[model samples]
Target: MGKPTGFMEYERSVSHAEKPKERIKHFNEFHQPLSMEERKCQGARCMECGVPFCQSGIIIGGMASGCPINNLIPEWNDSIYRGNMKQALSRLMKTNNFPEFTGRVCPAPCEAACTCSLNGDAVAIKENELTIIEHAYEEGYFKPNPPKVRTGKKIAIIGSGPAGLSAADQLNKRGHSVTVYERSDRLGGLLMYGIPNMKLEKQIIKRRINIMKEEGITFVTKADIGGNYNAEEIMKSYDSVILACGASNPRDIKVPGREAKGIHFAVDYLKATTKDILDRNKTLTPDFKNFTITAKGKKVLVIGGGDTGNDCVGTAIRQGAISVVQLEMMPKLPDQRADNNPWPEWPKVAKTDYGQEEAISLYGEDPRVYQTTVREFIADEQGNVCKAKIVRLESKFNEESKRFMMEEIAGSEYEIEVDMVLIAAGFLGAQSYVADAFGVELDVRTNVKTDAGNYQTNVDNVFVAGDMHRGQSLVVWAIREGREAAKAVDTHIMGYSNL
Candidate 1:
């Protein structure tokens, strides 16, 4: 702790963001970074408790409470407070491979679980972290550090997403020849495509990829293992294979008129939009086509109340959508923490995400409709989605199944005209083509079957991580799994791992 009374002396300070109306004109990051002096004050607020629940990463009441990767929160905060940004970044990188990505996108459970939050506001842990790493970059601290000796073993990673990138970083540091194969035309699977440039700029991802390349890690893009290249050839060539392909298969609505032309998956729509932006900016330099899905002057309807759904809402508003409405089957959560929710636990409260805030600023009302779902889609004469038939639902806990189920109420049906529908319900599991091509066994949920403690699959020389193994999850969890799987793969190759 830099100052024992820091929490008492200084109030919590957070970074300011651009006004919603101004930011809706274009797709760019709007969150302002805190100044160095302000960052120090924020870091000093870390109580650095004896227990330090910020790094505990426990699942209190079955919800995540702290940093999932067990980040050294107090140590880094002190380092920042003491004006030792180099030391602060070193501490931050000890656990997380990509602090820059997490700094911008993570929900910051550490702040929610902070000891100071009981009465006062929590320390600005997320901002402090972002400041440390950005300072490191500005001071020329980040550079390529290649391994001294090579293990002479080759490993194939079957995805270039967060999990695969984390695994590649660790395994390469352990002196193994690691090659990441991506089916997309460019690297950084979701990082390059699924996410908007405004949230995580593609240049940041490219900078890290360039550094990894300089450190002898190879990335081969547009290499589809199950389709273009033979999976058998990969198995015979590499000593071990890590399947880090994320869960890309989107969940679909089975209602009538689902086959309408204007209906699309949230991932597909986001990918296309980002790709167009990248192409127009000449970042990727691909021949641009006139494939347009713009929401300009069109009524937008987003189905599901998750992050992806919110992303769709934000993207539509930015594209100049005339109006937007998001539907959630479950009832709205309480505005504040409920009786069942306690301190140091993730609060289940109604909070405005970035997208909703943008929508409300533009439309003069909150766009979310709680306790509602689309029963069917209405198509125009051209077989394009023009409206949605929605119904309010009542949720109850099923005693036998121990799950919350929703049932549509009688005489609660309504209709809303719309030009586009984005489905963001959730993902079921990873696509089965690659898994089936390798003849790998799958669990009941269709995720790759792996033995506990050993992330290896039933198929010989094949390992799995990320959503392919554990189902859809946070980026932090995927990075952890990737690092652990790399250690396992290194052990399998050299008969032992120093990773």
Candidate 2:
């Protein structure tokens, strides 16, 4: 405890984000970090309670309650309060291999489980984490330190997303030769393309990839493990193979006119836009041609109400969409926690993300239309989506079925003009091709099957992790899965694991 009454004495604060309209002008990180003094004050707000649930990383009420990696929140927050960033970074790296990525993208369950949030604001653990790691980088303290000894074990990881990268990092540090294969034209997988530049710049990923390269971990891009590349060859070459390929299959809305030319999967749209931005080296001009399935001068409809949906809203606005609207099948959550929800549990509440914020600023209303789903897309003679048929939905609990189900309201149907449609309805599971190529079994959820509390697959010397093993999840969870899978591989190789 840096200060016994720090919780009471100092209030919580965080980085100041750029105004929505201004930030939409370009796709880059928009948050302005607080000064060292203000950040220190924010760190001092940590209560460091007897039972620090902030780092517990437990599941409460079916949701992650804290840092899934069990980050040493209190220890690092105290270090920040004392202005010892070196110590803070050390503590953070002890558990999380990629704090910089998490600091920027993670939803920060740690803050939700903070004791202080029971009454007031939680300590700025995420922001404090970002400050520490960013400071270390600027001071050259965050650098490569390769393992001194080689374990003489070779490992191959498929997919270069967060999970695969973390697994390679861990196994390499354990003195195992690690080679990562990415199917995409570039590395970072979703981190490289699926996400827009405003959330996380591509250069940030490149910087870390450079460090990993210096540390002796080999990365191979444009190498599809199960696609054109031979999967059996990998298993034969490497002592053990870890499949960290994320859940790459996007779910689709099986409504009428689903094959409209102007409609696209959210991931594909985002990837194209991001790649265009990187290639052109600038934001698309407002008057630029909408030669492909882009949002320019179009009234866009996003068919989901999650982070990806919000991302679509923001991306469309930047692409000069005339208007944007999002549809959600579920009912809107309460502004505050309900009776069934309490402290230390993941709060299910309404949040207006950056994309929605921008939409509201420009369109004068929230883009999300809850309890609504598109029934069909109306395409033009040219086979482009010209409008959408949407219907209001109501929830009903069937006594026998024992679950609440969404049913359409008979008279609540409506039609609206739309030029482009983006489906942000989340992922299904790991694409089956990879699993088939590896000849690994899949569970009921279609995720790679392993015994409970394990990462190894039914096939010996084969393992899985991240979304591929656990279904679609957060980046933090992916990192946790990767680290855990690395341990399993290490143990299997040496008959024991000190990883």
Worst 10 residues of 1 by lDDT: 282-291
Which portions of model 2 show Cα errors greater than 4 Å?
284-292
lDDT of 2 by residue, 147-230 (tens): 999989999999899999999999999999999999888899888888888888888899999999999999888888778899
Best by lDDT: 2
Model 1, 324-368: lDDT tens digits are: 999988889998788889888998888889999999888999999
- What is the Å distance of residue 54 in model 1 from its true position? 0.9
List of clashing residue pairs for candidate 1: none
The lDDT of each candidate is: 0.88, 0.91
Error of 1 at 87 (Å): 0.5
